[model samples]
Target: MLGAVVAVNLLDAGYAPYRGLFAVNIALVLGLWLVLPWSRGHRGRRLASPAFLVATFALGLTGSAGTHVPLTLLAIANVAFVFGMRMAAAILAGQAALMSAIPLAVGRPMADVLREVGFLVVFAAFVLGMVASVLRARQLAERVRELTVAQERGRMAAEMHDSIGHHLTVIKMGLENAERFRDRRPEAAWDEVRQAKELTAAALADARRWVRALRPLALDGHLGSAALERLADSFSGTGVAVSFDVTGTERLLGPDTELVLYRVLQEGLTNALRHAGARFVRGSLAFEKGKVVLVVADDGKGHGQGRGFGLSSLAERVEALGGTLSSGNAARGFELRAELPA
Candidate 1:
């Protein structure tokens, strides 16, 4: 609307009064208004040619001084801002070359005409700087998004391994007991049957916990004492004396941070049960030196039969949160330690 008004006002001023040229300016504004809506949710492509911009500016120069003021700069600025520096510079260079040659071709000196091209070069540089800044910001934001998603996937995988793996280890131990007492010790076989029944109950509980942890809505919330309780309950039937302790004031952490810590603890406990073969598993959380420290230790025989997923998953999860995981023999058994930025 504003461009159309400017076009009409220029025509009314009656300077050079090219009615046909003003009509084209009005059509350009209307055409742009229609085109802009179709470019929604995407970058707009530059379509205005150097010839079009030069012709529009030359036409406006013949209007009244008031109309020429806005038109002269507007055309150059439009081409400079939209199509980029090189194209804008090319347009200015072409205009300068044409203006200088036209006067020379008619046997005249046009030295002052080339000076106008300098202004276009400056405008193009300014627009290029702005475009560069915007592109840099976009790249930084995209990198952050990719890292966030990767952390989330690592957290979910650790959660699945801890819950399911803990129960399966117990079931494997129970079946081993049943096999040892199957023939000669029928009476002892009855005890193994009872252990299998308990293992099955634990497995069912584990399945429920796995489903709950995997739920999208549940994962969004803070993994507070409630999540810790779930870990302790999962180990109840395994005959390991499991203890959980929290010493912090329970401030809320970032979503990704909380999930990572939860998985670290979960996997550590499962590792104690499966690899350490510990009779005592203890978990503690505390705030120390401006950091959150979580430790899971077991008084079990570390380095038992085979490789375990628990400790490996725990390390991956803790590292994802910019934390470290350290494990070794802690006097009587195995220990897993994690430290996360608070």
Candidate 2:
């Protein structure tokens, strides 16, 4: 649309001998615009390189004619808006130099040439500034979108850990208890087996809930203690006796902070039941003067050398929020602890 408007205005200004050249310049610009790939992907820029070359050729044609037409200005503005400010400025400077030299070489009066060059310079500056501002705004909007996506992914991960991990841990504990008591206490073993079956049914429901609520779940002023208690209750049928306690003044935490804390507890309890073969687990959340502290300890065999996938993920979550996480053998068992600033 812009190209057609500019071409008609330029043709109306009357350069009868250069009519064909003006038409060719317009064709080249239109062709470049048509062939340019405008997708938001890596290949878009690569594919658009040929269009840039076509734009350069169109600018050359406009300059060689030495007619007071705005074809070059149109090309420069389009390139700047599409490619970026730096490339646009470079093309503008080079085209200005070439256009100025053309009239001088033709023995046009110095004052007239200077006046034309001055007008081109002012116009190019205005176009460059406008294009630069637009590019900056585009970049900022893209960054915001990226951040929003990353945050959503983090939230879903936390929710998945809390929901799925709790159910799986309960099922595992139930099976383990059933196997251990089958020979000595058949009735108790049967009860554990029944509990495991119920947990599997509940797990299916929880899975749907997590899927339906992909958005971040708020603490709703409960902080994280209510969720922790629910997690502790799921382990009831298992031999593992789990306990949860909260200390210090309970205050609202940022969503990210609460998520990290919840995940740390979930992952810790999961590792305790699944890997450590722990019969007893104790978890605590303490809100201190300037920070919150979480500890999950299990009376099971401690880690020998390296961390597992769950611990690695937990560590990353804690560290990203400017917190510290440590896991090692305590006096009698394995312990995972995280401290985060409130």
Candidate 3:
């Protein structure tokens, strides 16, 4: 509709109606073609589609260059085709140079035409820069997300290794003890058998906890003190001093913010325990100064010297919320601070 309005305005401004219609049609067709499935990842299809689009756009712009269709439009179409199609970039650049110089062919003043040419160069350069920036940002975000998922899986596996694997190792030791004393001390052997049974039960419980940790928790809308307390309680037996601090009174934080905040805390605490070698950890959440601040600190050795999944996942979650995560050695020890807008 906006394009149609612009086309009509151009016609009212003395450009021919046929030229206005042609320009509108070119814009509409290009928009539709860019949305096609083939445009997503298939390089070949992208190249062909944009080539046709640029060709049609060039025809329309060339037909009404000085009237309604500006020289910048020609440059823009060229740039779009250049980026969207692999080989088309150079082709469009050359085409734009030739077409923008067409005014010189028609006996027009070089100075007047040079003005549009200058604007075209600036506009094309700006668009190209914006496109490059957006593409780079998207690429970085994708890499972060990939690393986040990989880190989650690694954390889950480590938990399994620490819990279930440790239990299995203990059971093997108990079996060896019982076998050595089988004849000499049958009663002692019986005790080892019982110990193995107890170990099996504990291992099963660890397995359940591991599975629960993998499953996502459905958060309540209340976002109350009770919810935070329950989360703290779940980590009570993990040999870590876990705490929850809520400065602002409990109220319903919108679902998106609540979910992101919970995940951030979970990832941060998991990192402190698994990587920081800290026996005691503190988790705090406060709403102040028009922002929600979450801090997870540990008195253990700071973030490991190498990259890990926990930090990656935490960073991804923090960034997704338009927030930031800071990790450094606090006065007592290592600390992670995550801040998000309320």
Maximum-TM-score candidate: 3
Tell me the whole-model lDDT of each prediction, alpha carbons only: 0.63, 0.72, 0.64
Q: After superposition, how far is residue 257 of candidate 2 from its true place, in Å?
A: 29
Candidate with better lDDT, 1 vs 2: 2
Off by over 4 Å in 3: 1-88, 109-113, 147-154, 211-342
Predicted structure 3, TM vs. truth: 0.53
lDDT string, candidate 2, 1-342, tens digits: 444445554655555556677567666666666665432343545445446455545544553343323545655666665566677788767767876798799999989878877888998788778767777887896796578457656866876787778989999999999999999999999999999999897787656544433423333444467766665555555567899999999887876787778777777776676568889999999999999999999999877878865677668778888999999988877999999989
Candidate 2 lDDT for residue 285: 90
Q: In candidate 3, residue 169 scores what lDDT?
A: 98
Model 3 poorest ten-residue lDDT run: 66-75
Cα displacement (angstroms), candidate 2, residue 149, comes to: 1.0
Q: What shift in Å separates residue 198 of candidate 1 from its native position after superposition?
A: 8.0
lDDT of 3 by residue, 236-322 (tens): 776778777777754566555665676666666666655677888888888777678878787887764644555666677778778
On lDDT, the leading prediction is: 2
Q: Candidate 1 residues 1-342, lDDT tens each?
A: 245455555557564456566557556644553443211133443453334454455544534333442343445555555565565567656755765677578866455444544554565456546645655675686797588567656766676666567767877886787788889887787887787788777677657655544543233352665576566666666667888888867666766666666766766676675457688888898866667888888888765443355556557767877888887777888777888888
How big is the positional error of residue 307 in model 1, measured in Å on the Cα after superposition?
31
